[model samples]
Target chain A: MPFEEKFHLRIPGPTPVPLRVQHAMNRPMIGHRSAECSRLVQKCSQRLQSVFGTRENVLIIAGSGTSALEAAVANTVAPGEEAVVVVTGAFGDRFAKIADRFGARVHRLDIPWGEACSPDALKSFLLSRPRVKAVFLTHCETSTGVLNPVRDLAQIVREHSDALVIVDGVSSVGGVPCEMDAWGIDIFVTGSQKALMLPPGLAFVAVGPRARKVIRQAEAPRFYLDLQAYQEQLEKETTPFTPAIAHLFGLEAALDMLDEEGLENVFARHRLMMEMTRAGIRALGLPLLAEDAVASPTVTAVRGTETIDATALQKELRRIGVVVASGQQHLKGKIFRIGHMGYCDPLDVLTLLSATETALHRLGKPVRWGAAVAAAEEVWSRV
Target chain B: MPFEEKFHLRIPGPTPVPLRVQHAMNRPMIGHRSAECSRLVQKCSQRLQSVFGTRENVLIIAGSGTSALEAAVANTVAPGEEAVVVVTGAFGDRFAKIADRFGARVHRLDIPWGEACSPDALKSFLLSRPRVKAVFLTHCETSTGVLNPVRDLAQIVREHSDALVIVDGVSSVGGVPCEMDAWGIDIFVTGSQKALMLPPGLAFVAVGPRARKVIRQAEAPRFYLDLQAYQEQLEKETTPFTPAIAHLFGLEAALDMLDEEGLENVFARHRLMMEMTRAGIRALGLPLLAEDAVASPTVTAVRGTETIDATALQKELRRIGVVVASGQQHLKGKIFRIGHMGYCDPLDVLTLLSATETALHRLGKPVRWGAAVAAAEEVWSRV
Candidate 1:
């Protein structure tokens, strides 16, 4: 079978893994209970603190970002408790759903799909819901390519109510700026498949001391996704369950790559790619779902015009070995998302813009031969 | 850094992953929502049916074996519901704990740590509990290296109560005989490690029609581990959440390898290795924890004598590049387990035996010379 080395993957997640991370994950398997694995787990957990921008030892769960979100919810909210979810996009709705499923009395604070939840709006929402146990917020609304002002919102949640401030940074943590402690984030979660530059399997949760104490006393019914067991085991440099061992190996390499690149540089690169992608998309005469003020550095959603269908454009891009994400849920056929997170660069953005131009030309839409690429090049030059 | 090519991975789970599978996992990443990934997930689920010896498509989750076990419990037992957990070893205790945490009326029928629950005992125990909702049983207890009589015990459960027969085949699925449908198993779960010849992370669960019905009505609070959502998305050839893409690639390769060497042949190879390891250990004057009649084909637990310390032997073997499992929980210093499943052959067992001899000598034990090797050679020749 042929390999996918040449294919350009621009999806919001399950992003392209670097060859180095792949090789790291391909190393020979070691015993999970062996001293070698124990040391590796301990080191990875410690290093992940730098990525999450927290002093707490991050707890790794062998599951998806959704699993991490569930861990945050399950550990903090019990049945009949109140949780306020800031529903900015699909992922916010997902958090709300999990809260409801766990029997929490959920109050969803809805914003426009591509809009960010302002701190004033959150403060007003939390004013009446004085008995809230936790407030779930999304750092990057992946489904709509919007980045919420999480630090500001978390600060508001802390002052207005007694709710724990939990943030989902799945698609933004490493690529976007996240200062968990300074932001007063009680619980922070991310996944390996997003900006972490690895396959989807492992979920990392960074919890503050207060959150850990709350998790211990929380009455939410849980077993596998419980955060308390993970913390206890993590204190001993092991996991409650057998971890995704190979992913941890890949994570070590990915973390080292991020360290070498420097956290500030990584965030800058993501911002540059997002700027380039948005500029190119705008030049192509297509509308963007998110505004510049709320645009995500990790992903950007572009809307289709009457002349060009988003679904058709996605299909055309895939046919040309460039894959992008189509609109999800109610926005189907309306927008397509381009991922500029982990393993992506200016060159990748240029390639996607070039492919979009070609796909548009093939769809009978008039396009200046290199208008999108030229716009992307202008951003590259300015940066 | 030097590779671990010569090291013997002798743990029960997190078994040695084959080089071919490792290379397969190193392939470039693809969009998880793309048609390619959809096809991959569908094909792997279908192919897994053969390994599980079931007609139902196995639903894969992005987590460890423990997560799969938790899924089974959380999806079937509601709060205040009755469930029977047959506790034969550590894993069985884990199942009971999960059930208990889920607020089920958990009845743990405890057997000796190193012994399997007898069919007669289970039959009589179930007779008094007519309202049992499910029975959790381990096919192979890795802690004690005992293979339970799942088929017979499941048959008895089917006859006596209306309880669903749930089996944990984490360390046995690809290397042991598990006729799920024939044995009347309602729900069966396993993980990517162990006999699957891959690093840990992905969990596979296969459910019968009856089990699905009960799970749909189950009142246990869950979101990430909700199997119903997984089943619905699986019907559309996708997952409810992001899957471990690289592990799925490795799983496809592992399944192909299993197909090449038929499932029966794979089981035979594991049995051969188990026999060889057990013979060598007995010849070295070590006592076997599990009786020969109930010994696991994938792993063998050998107890240390007064003159030999299991902990010291494990340390010495590791110094010589051999890794084995120490007894867990209460048996921490009494026994050492040698894994013989997944990528292990008679040669690997013989190499381990030689290392054991050397370690024993280093630890001031009597010189066995070539006694262990000779015994292993005799077993290898007979096989």
Candidate 2:
């Protein structure tokens, strides 16, 4: 039965958009330069600032999370300038690559996959590289389901070096607590997809005063991804180019949903979902890819066993209308992932765990039929 | 009457999205890496090829029109290599600027603002610059409502130089006739906001064999706008990054609408709409910005007289719940544009013309009360 009619999307992003958000996107598109568009953008920016935990307005771009990551590098770090990029997984590697592509002399601090970057190690690296202009790190490495110590890393950068602390908060911002202003993050980049509960298209970059100053003098060959244009238009409460208007409408609705639920409650819900997913995995005799201390609240990665083919398990789950993500990059076929981010709740996690258990048993792996569900239900009931 | 609730958007690129397309965006989002996603992308690619009038697959990027223009330069034109950028209007100048930003030695062929780049002039320039790696030209210069002869110019490049002919069809592809394969064009770039009848956020670039070969060997510093990554993933029927899935859903529906109407019929409708708009402007005693021979079929630019302030006219139109675009760049306040592109019909054109005449009369410009509407209706009746 193709499951095409109604499938439970469990991928990291293009995460499942809520029905309200989808209906919001059904609204008519306003002209990008119209006063209506300006008002909508202004409202969205203010709400995004609240979600980002920042006082400054967030700049929205009509691209993916990667574009926002590139903007962080292209806007602040000039050619031949030094920046420290901490690589924990695929997304971290991507951040460093974008910096390198923009001609920044990058000091790559590579951490093992499924692990978060240590603040002390990053500080040591910054100490060695005294003239670093920026430090790039991922808050939640989506590829490995590990959450880096962004606040500690930002503090280390503040104490050790005069470098801008730029974070790729693509998968963590709305789902987790990221106080950009209180944490002294110079630049925080995220996408509308993951935890924002919208489809992939709009990327938001919240820039602090220090990064804005650097952007004024930064020499990068950029036009479309230029932050200055976005910044200038943002002052007028509009975007420089044509934005993804439908997505912005969806964003407005998604933000309303988030606000109604309350941000703290949203964070707690994500944490609970992650805990339930982890407990369910443990009950099914599956090992998690990330350590409990570093496990992400947005997505959970499960290590694949020899007996259970991760790809086949994913396929089996998809057949029954559950869609989880297979591993990415080097982790392909080594681990499978279940995304509990954006528009997800306890019931969704329970559904995923139940479906996973069925797929495992059907694939001739284990005999724990309802163990995973019971474990997940325990976490839900306690919450 | 705030007009904010129901304003008619008549901009060139962001033409009004149809009801069906907007409703399509309300559908549930599937995982971007799911089998369903592959099937949808594959179907979208095939339909996009038909719309773009190309045999090759069109690469879809989750960005605005400008990003696709940047991809054209960053993918095929290496830094320090010579390329000819034919400038006719604001978008034309933008194309040159993007190439210059990428460190290309740009030989700019600047034409007047409201005039199309002459094929003979481009041929002469290509003859002089025989070693030019690429030539950038705008198919429909939206800023001034001028349509450059892409077909004739591509022929000139073939006969005069081995340079890759790259055309920015951002506002022209789906509205008018652009035979990519037949015209010997190497690369044709467009956006989803225009005649595609979808909202902004998706950009399409159709590359021919020669351009693909050049892209494989080009040495440009890029990551997100990298065509090579997109080309590689096109084989797998997926995008390299998280795409604007909601926009793609809208795009699929928009393409279905275009297919239902038929491409030839779509072109004819655009042409008729343009003729009607021009006739209305003439009857209102306003001169067109572009000459009749070079005028665009998607949008019509009318020169504002002293009595009729372009900004005031646009504002007045908006007050009556009709929104038209004012001129861009240096032409701002000197002219106004009415987009007759996607999702627009004869009735819409008549309404725009009637509203324009009302605005002109109220602004103290001596416009005959129903002359503009009668002229437009005359053309519509004949059609």
- The per-candidate TM-score of the B chain, in the order shown, comes to 0.98, 0.98
Q: Which ten residues in a row have the lowest lDDT in candidate 2 chain B?
A: B1-10
Instruction: Give the TM-score of each candidate.
Output: 0.98, 0.97
Clashes of each: 0, 0
Q: What's model 1's lDDT at A146?
A: 98
Q: Write the per-residue lDDT of candidate 1 for residues A93-169, one digit (tens) a residue.
A: 99999999988999999998989999999999999989999999999999999999998999999888878999999
The deviation in Å at residue B306 for candidate 2 is 3.0
- Compute the lDDT of residue B7 as modeled in candidate 2: 71
lDDT string, candidate 2, B1-383, tens digits: 55456777787868888888877887788888877778888788888998778999799999999999999999988879999999998998999999998889999999989998888899888888878989999999999999999999999998888899999999998999989999999999999999998989999999999999998987677889999889999899999888888888888899889889999999999999999999998998888999889999999998877667778988899888787888988999999888889999988988888998888777777777899889988988897
Candidate fnat values, all: 0.96, 0.84
Q: Please report, as a residue range, the 10-residue window in candidate 1 chain A with the lowest summed lDDT.
A: A1-10
Best by DockQ: 1
